[model samples]
Target: MIFTLRPYQQEAVDATLSHFRRHRTPAVIVLPTGAGKSLVIAELARVARGRVLVLAHVKELVAQNHAKYCALGLEADIFAAGLKRKESQGKVVFGSVQSVARNLDAFQEEFSLLIVDECHRIGDDEDSQYQQILTHLSKVNPHLRLLGLTATPFRLGKGWIYQFHYHGMVRGNDNALFRDCIYELPLRYMIKHGYLTPPERLDMPVVQYDFSRLQAQSNGLFSEADLNRELKKQQRITPHIISQIMEFAQTRKGVMIFAATVEHAKEIVGLLPADDAALITGDTPGPERDALIDNFKAQRFRYLVNVSVLTTGFDAPHVDLIAILRPTESVSLYQQIVGRGLRLAPGKTDC
Candidate 1:
């Protein structure tokens, strides 16, 4: 099947090509959460002269991107061990960073273009898996070009990916991963164009903990373990919050509740309507998680509680109500959480 891009998406592709021609360096494309990034990636692979490697942080994204390529009549191979796939010399390869990080040497083929999905995750740390893989690949393919795609381009403390510079050490004042942002589709533009649902922040307070006392981690965010412990103390108060959420989202069709930890998620599920609510976390088995997500998407459940699972690649347009039970300082995390409900639905005027 032939695929077509929206006007802005095509423009983004054109801008990326022009930047590469002029500067010959890595570039990033900042598109909204619901924007068709995979389409731009597909078009890139279609026009590429050599092999293309699409790197995603999660298996879900790797599969999602590969599926889009396949629908567009592109032959793609998966490099994720979790999916039981091996590296191949396919023209297009969808790779999970976690799976391929350890086996970079296994992929002997030198790719001409490296498209990083959710590329904002490439941190400043030189020893990070992303940097490690790139460092190794640079020697093999000196002329390899990078194309980063992300909704949020800035890190917690690293400023923007384009201006990321690490000082003090062996690699002081190092070059950033991307030369510049070639294209940016702002959230306001997407909302104004009716491509995404306009979010309405509910004033209901979900947690009642002394967040000020929580110590921050290196990323300038509260430690997950500490936050979870604090959240656990509020388990007894979840039923009240659930009741308030139910009242606030009375007319909404689907509700997604984000929690700090698996135990907190379980507590939320216990408080919610047992027959209409489900919980999923990183620990949940793959089959069970998929089933829960499928059920939630099918509208079998009015509420779905999750912990660090349903943030990015998961799409549920009917989720008009988002109860952010988990508080996060990371702009990317906040965007992803709110973005779960940003896809435009038939009657979804407010998110």
Candidate 2:
């Protein structure tokens, strides 16, 4: 299969390569949800005719990248569990961050390039898996070049991707993970250009619980336990949200509900007709989760509810309504949750 690139995607590829050639340092590329980043990554691997490791946090993304590489007629091997064993001699390897983080030295040869998908997950903390793995890899090969791709390159408590130093303190806090953003394709621009569906956002007034007393985490977000406790106090909120979803989804084909907890998701499913809805969470068994996702994609159900899952790598293009029952302070999470409905499906004018 021949891979074709749109003008913007080509620009992204060129800009990333050009930045690498000029600076010889790590770089990041920001592209909207529906902008086809896999094609760009395929082209980069095709051009960089050396050992390249594509890293993603989730298994779905690892599999997705390998599929695109195969579609592009590129020889790539998967290094993640449930995919393939670690291929020491393969030039291109698609890897899950969790799977390969411990075995950086397993590869016989030094990788010339490291491409990180969903790279914004790299936290400011030095003890993070990403930082630890990259630090070890750098010790092995000092001249390695890195390319990071993400739609949102900023973290909640941590600053932007290319941020160098904080406002007041300049001596110690020089935390610029990626040197520069080589290219960016904004979601608004993609919507304007008809590449993505514009989100029709609606606000539902829910009873606000006083969470002011809840202890804030170091990341400036409330702890999950506290948030869940606060959310559980408002008994009317879940019913109201369920009613709103039922009302709005009456005219839509598929609705994705992001719940705060597994209990909340089960409650949502309890409200809907048993056969019309399903629930999935991180704790769900692998086979059950896959089946639920497949059934949802097959349109066997009108509503799919998930907690702390399906926000990043799950893709259901026909989802016309995204009901965010989980309130989040992270902008990346908010965008990712809404992005589920941003894919341009037939007759989907707005999400």
Candidate 3:
């Protein structure tokens, strides 16, 4: 089975290959959320020389990327504990950082290229799991090349993920993980090219929650404790917000609601129709979470309320309405949350 890459995807692959030819420093590729990054990863792996290892922070991403690579009639092994597999001898291997970091000794083979899916998650902390894995891999192959792919290159409190962007879109930090951004695909370009759904923001709601009074932590994000206390005081307003969401969702096919916390998610779910809604949090059992997500994607329910779990790896293309009930200072997080609805699905003209 052969798959053809889109023009922009091929361009991304070309840019990455071109970057590696000129420099040995690590670089990143920035593509919008809805873009087919998995395909690009697969293409790069196909053309890459020597053994390749693709790393993702979550098991879902490892599985998804591996599946895409395999769909091209390629053989690749998955090294994620969540998937109950840990084969590392294949020329191309997809792995979750946690699993790979824990069992670094299991991998006897040396890899030439290391690709990180959500590279922005890599911080300057040398003790972090990603850093630990990279350090080990670098020891195995000192000349190893690193490539990162992500939609949002900026971290929450930190600035850019790369020290220098291709066009200097923004200032980069000296402590950034990746050294440069070799290629970037803009969200506007994707929308203009019909590759993604155009997002439409509704007018200000009649009832709104004011997060201005909440204090910010040193990380430039609101503390969950402060948010919870403030939410408790404004508990009366949650119903009004849900009411507006419900009214808006009546015309939408699929709706995803992002809540501040688990308790808030449960409260919102309780207010919604039980049969038509479901709640998912980090604590939800793995099998149960998978089932809930499967059902939601199958349109078993119209509303899915979650807290921090569905921001990155989860995918539901039919989602036409995104109700962000939480507040965040991170531009990356905000874009990720809203990206859930930006996928171009049949009958979904806009989000």
Candidate 4:
């Protein structure tokens, strides 16, 4: 299949090429979720002569990226754990930082380009697989170009978008390593673009938020160093809370409930409107996990309750109700989940 890039996406590709011509160094492109960032990167991989290293963080995301680029006529290989590289000398390689961060000696400097997905995590500090990647690249492929892509470009601690300017990550920065690829498509923009449907949402209406008990548990009323023991006890009472959500979302189509733990996910599944709910996590085996996502996308399931596993790099266009039972401090994650619901439906925006 031939790939036709979007206007902003094409602009990003052109800007990346221009940057490459000038710096011959890796660069970052910040684009919103569902903006077809993968498609752009995939096109780059298709045209790349030498190896192209595409590094994603999660296994699911790694798999998603591998599939996308492979579809672009780029012979892509996966180096994730439990997955082996193909015999095809494929020009594109999708590696998970979790899978290969500690083993850079093997892939170091081998590829001419390094693509970091969800790159707001790269930040100014040195840590995580990102820091490890920079360390390896600086030593091995000092001239190796970096192409970072993310929806939100700021970290949790960075208060303002202006900090991105100072960090030299924003296009506004004079010493910017990579110019802004495109920040035009926020979730709202995606909705206007007909890529996502606006979601229906309500603040979960429970008489109580389990506040006092949570405070007590935190202040040491529990025997465990963890909060699970208390959270589970509290969730047993959540069935009553589910009734409220059911009533509020009764007319809504699909819902995703994000939780803190597997047990929490399980309880959410149980409390869901029944017969149409499922759970997904890192623990779910391959076929089953894939099925859940497929079914969710196919509208076979109306609800999917999961942990942090599904937050990033996951998209179900028909999902029109975002039920956030999960707590988050990161803007990147918050925007990511919200972006999932912003794709415009058929009558509205771009395909």
Candidate 5:
């Protein structure tokens, strides 16, 4: 690719490739959101001449990885279910684990190297489609060079980078799960870098986040046993929270709101200044989504309310404000939402 690689990014990619060549074993890359992990993968594919198979967890990610590889000059093909193939006749194929799992017997296994994006999602044992992919790959090619990439290496409920030394899938020095961290590159840093609109820091205000009704619907009590149930009916961002977000947005031009559900997102749109708000959800038709994106780029939408989407791939440089309305125990998810504001905009003024 013609793009320049940051020092840290190059080092991360170098470390991963070194591991792959060293032990002939799988290696993982831990990069925060907005750190251009996709670019790192592209760089790897550029140098490695073998037929590369990239396995992504979701449809959106599959599309993103495919486009990124193509941009990096890798001939790419996608075998994801229900998705049409583009013109990128790929030496590298990006496939959904589910799609390949369903059509395993009919597919070819000539790929010499395999890359797993978000490898932490590879479920336990050989039961899940992910684990099944690993098994199938081993059966098809014994000398496969495997590489995994994700922000968080430790699987949920698994111990930190320390306890996962022998966690079956994690590669590299178990202690080096983290590189020099890049957390300082959040919204505050972006504002300082002039990448976003100057933060119009007005007098601080008090805004309450009311979770009463949601708590009431979710058995009126918090419990690990009720998490999934609570997530289903609970409001991702409450009206009080929305008011605070609006206040914050008033200080910035473009704002990004992360909500829990479609219904919650609709409520957020209603609360934002009408005629200047856009909402994107999984059900948003493709054409409509493209239009919304265009309008957003045109700055017609001051606030973008989103539900469970836009955590990755979707990029808006004007996103000066980010509302983490969704409660998540995942550090990776939190970092992803926050990194939406990390792009360094030069010559920006601090408000």
Candidate 6:
């Protein structure tokens, strides 16, 4: 191995191997953000017999995981369209779900083990890309062992990702993708052990938007339209929030602002220094988005205001301050957002 696995990370891999030895059912390994899940995935793939396939929701993660696996002096293929590479015939393949779902015939029963990074994105929808690929691949390879790694194990509306959690007895979901959480590394444990930066919540903002009147859908999240309407009713709320964020960011190295919407992100960017801040929404073009993210990591900018894009699969260890201007009732979503700043970096004390 090129890099030594941390104690908890090796434990996670051991738990996974043990689970597969005892049962054929799918299992999950819950590791918080910045806990080096990619390394664990690499080690697991390295040890697994037969071909392996690693799935990620976005191209960023597809590339990230592929790089980690390669760092072991091992060979693997990448099958993500966004990265403009699609080589499926290899001992190990890292692929984006969209590209793989569209071309399942190339992979047909070839893999013995499948690893999904950020598996919580696999929803209950049977027709979803992830489900479609899983159904097709499992049909061809009945002995295929499935493993998932995620920071947040629960979905916003759908409770848990697995039928059982090792942490404790939890509510069950028959439709959950994985059968059990074979292992988990707690956020508090990582913080106490100095593996991650501790998160400290700031005082309540002087101005707060009233979301009480908004009703949640069956999915347990307010509709985007409703959130925008409610936010509009709060007079000068965005301005006040941005002002407070700027005040707090003065002492931080890197600041990330989670905006409620695209327009909201733009407004926040407008309030920040034009040269020191950048906005990234789902609509940003691919090349421009990549450049913006690269610049932010290089410290060319101080504040990065994004809308629902940087929650997962983004790595910038220098980020120490995270301003959540968006309101969410989902614990999983909130945790994923805050986890962005919890990575350890030089000269960084806490998030």
The top-ranked prediction according to TM-score is 3
- Residues 69-159, candidate 4, lDDT per residue (tens digit)? 7776656678787455522235677888876776776664456788888776565556767777767766775667777887876555443
Quick one: ranking by TM-score, best first? 3, 6, 1, 2, 4, 5
Relative to the true structure, candidate 4 reaches a TM of: 0.79
Displacement of the residue 245 alpha carbon in candidate 2, Å: 1.0
Best by lDDT: 3
Q: Is candidate 3 or candidate 6 better by lDDT?
A: 3
Candidate 6 ranges with C-alpha deviation above 4 Å: 167-170
Q: Which ten residues in a row have the lowest lDDT in candidate 6?
A: 214-223
For all predicted structures, in order, the TM-scores are 0.92, 0.92, 0.97, 0.79, 0.75, 0.96
The CA lDDT of each predicted structure is 0.82, 0.80, 0.90, 0.67, 0.64, 0.89
TM-score of 2: 0.92
User: Order of candidates by lDDT, top first?
Assistant: 3, 6, 1, 2, 4, 5
What candidate 4 gets wrong by more than 4 Å, as runs, is 24-26, 82-89, 123-127, 158-184, 205-237, 345-351
lDDT of 1: 0.82
What lDDT tens digits, residue by residue, belong to model 2 across residues 35-77? Answer: 8888888889889956888899988888888898899866888
Error of 4 at 117 (Å): 0.6
Residue 210 in model 5: lDDT: 38
What's the lDDT for residue 4 in model 3? 90
Clashes of each: 0, 0, 0, 14, 5, 0
Is 4 or 6 the stronger prediction by lDDT?
6
Clashing pairs in 5: 75-90, 75-91, 76-90, 194-345, 195-345
